[model samples]
Target chain A: MWQKLYTWLDERLGLGDMYANLLDRPEPKGNWWNTLGSASLFLFILQGATGIFLTVYYTPSPDHAYDSITYIMNDVAFGWLIRGIHHWGASLMVLVVFIHMVRVFVTASYKYPRELTWLIGVGLLLLTLGMGFTGYLLPWHQMAYWATTVGTQIAGSVPFLGEFILKALRGGPDLSALTLQRFFSAHIWMLPALLAGLIGVHLYLIIRHGESHFPDEED
Target chain B: MSGSHLSRRDFMKAATGAVGGVITAALGIPVIGFLIAPALREDKAGAPIAVGKLEDIPVGKFHPFSFTITKVNGWERTASNYGGFILRNSEAPDDILILSSRCTHLSCTVNWNESANAFLCPCHDAKFGPEGQVLDGPPPEPLGHFEYSVDDQGVLTIVPVELKSEA
Candidate 1:
């Protein structure tokens, strides 16, 4: 009965073809190092889940923002564990993504047909850091406030457009309620949207080129 | 013989399904609780805050005053600063108006500009009149007010919640 149901659904969904193309494809023998890409993907999914859970209790306003997070950590059931996973997941994702890049570089996987993949990977790395930067301020704590103040100030010191960039990032002369609001928007919406889109393209490119074989003495 | 009937491929498939189910439950159950806990809890309101002595505030002029509400949630304690303008309309204890200094546009603190006779928000250049009416700038509405009561000793106390004011 189950087999019949699966066959019927598979015929409509092209499930067999999808499984063959997406999962059962050929690849060069991979070592433990090859697991980093999937590991990063896992961490990204975990972070996304935990972050969504956090937003249920998190407030963007300066008034209740810190207290709200404190409530999450102290009162909410399993909130600490979820937040802990997300907090540590972010650091681990960055490390894993960077090491994945290094592994690709060492293997010269960015050569030729896979250059676009490398480029998208670089974009993903940047968006990940952008996520970190924007998420840091949501708590509205003193540390997050001052760090962002210095961070945006550095951006404002650019050559000619420094002032504009500073104002654009800060939404004004200095970090205020608007800064916190905008950062919340970017962290949860804008950057994640871009990252998700870029990740789709990155994964497609990897599938297209297949995992590049580890380079040997071959020219 | 009986054990040999469980082929390696079948055994692997069953193992994978079990592992996948375990992983899903491991993260899913706690996460659901985490997301729903806040909704299940009761909302706590701030206690009545005493701003200052009503006798000290001059009549017909807005005086700046601030108060801090410290909240202890879980293991952390945070003190949030809130300020407003107090206008003692007359010698009558009940005849007074208190307006929050928070700019309606973006919650930036507005300052009383004695020269301009208006509360000016530094962040967006918003201005408010003596009655907390929006005078100029991006503020969507007038400054908010607080519910207050004056005791026999002329001590003015206000509920910290910002109430919307018409006009």
Candidate 2:
């Protein structure tokens, strides 16, 4: 009976050689800027994991947001640790990504064939910063609120489309509860999804074009 | 330094440095993060912050000190403000009074009226005497005082208390 089940499961799920082929762990080698890419990936996963745990307890409403965070910090199991990881992981993610950009730029990896990937990479970095800034405001504390207010106000400064930009960001004239909901959606769903899609395409391009040349190179 | 003679030592040293730069860039961020993450983050729910010098905070003068805590205090991210007072009262003998900046009437902050010797709340013209007593106008009570102390260094420290009436 067990043999039959194993055969049936293998036939259906097809586990044979899947991990070996799909995750062959490529030479573990790339240019100097290479490891930063992996570090960014690691931080992203950490953020996602911790963020999910936080979401379970976080309340997006103005009425309960502060209370929710307090509860998470003071009462929830290992809440502070989880919050710590999320906060630190987010910052680390951005830092690593920014360094990745710097390495690419300084090394002239943006030249020629990799320009599209570089642009997408630049876009991804901006998006990461955008995500962190918006997420920073979600807690609705004094600093978060005022800082975000300052930021959105800056966005409101853009010529011609400033009003439209603010409206799109806040979903109205002011930073109301709707703004919180909007930002929350953007942080957790919209921006993250966009980031994932962009990163996928970015990596695909990288694979297609091959890694850029290091500072000292054959080519 | 002959052009054709690249010694094994030189090649190894250069290779080590190149690899070292990459690895350092890669691991440097996480290490700094792990070490400094606590300071970069705020408690959001109100972290306990300590402010300075009870003796040095000359009467009628306020001072500024900042500590890291979460800025996400509400669902809307309100900026937290903390205030301290150094007063020489015959009865209390150089006691410290730390207060929330919120006005009693509608929660706007009350500016210290050094010239008038009071906390002046503009929202409703509420005035709090030096002792935080209700002096005049629409405010029903004093500005909220905080949990405070003079450390071994005689530096004043205070707990952040919510202003406005409990109601």
Candidate 2 per-residue lDDT over residues B38-123, each given as its tens digit: 34543433445556655556654454344433354323455544444445342242454555566767878777777988888878
Best by lDDT: 1
Clashing pairs in 1: none
Model 1 agreement with the true structure over A128-214: per-residue lDDT tens digits: 999988988888898999999999999999999999999999999989999999999999999988988998899898888888888
Model 1 lDDT per residue over B1-167, tens place: 77678888689779978987997898999988887774575545677888888768898888889987676544357677888888888888888899998899998999899899888999989999988899999999888888899888889999877522211
Q: Give the 10-residue window scoring lowest on summed lDDT in candidate 2 chain B.
A: B66-75
Residue B165 alpha-carbon offset, candidate 1, angstroms: 30
Binned by DockQ into CAPRI classes (incorrect, acceptable, medium, high), candidate 1 is acceptable
Which residue runs does candidate 2 get wrong by more than 4 Å? A1-32, A215-219, B1-167
Worst 10 residues of 1 chain A by lDDT: A210-219
- The TM-score of predicted model 1 comes to 0.66
DockQ for all models, in order? 0.34, 0.03
lDDT of 2 by residue, A1-219 (tens): 998997898788875555344433244345556679767876776677678768877998898888888877875556677788788888888889999888888878899988899899988998899889889988899988898888899999999999999888888989889989989989999888988899889877866676765646565
Q: Is the docking of candidate 2 incorrect, acceptable, medium or high quality?
A: incorrect
Q: Number of clashing residue pairs in every model?
A: 0, 16
TM-score winner among the candidates? 1
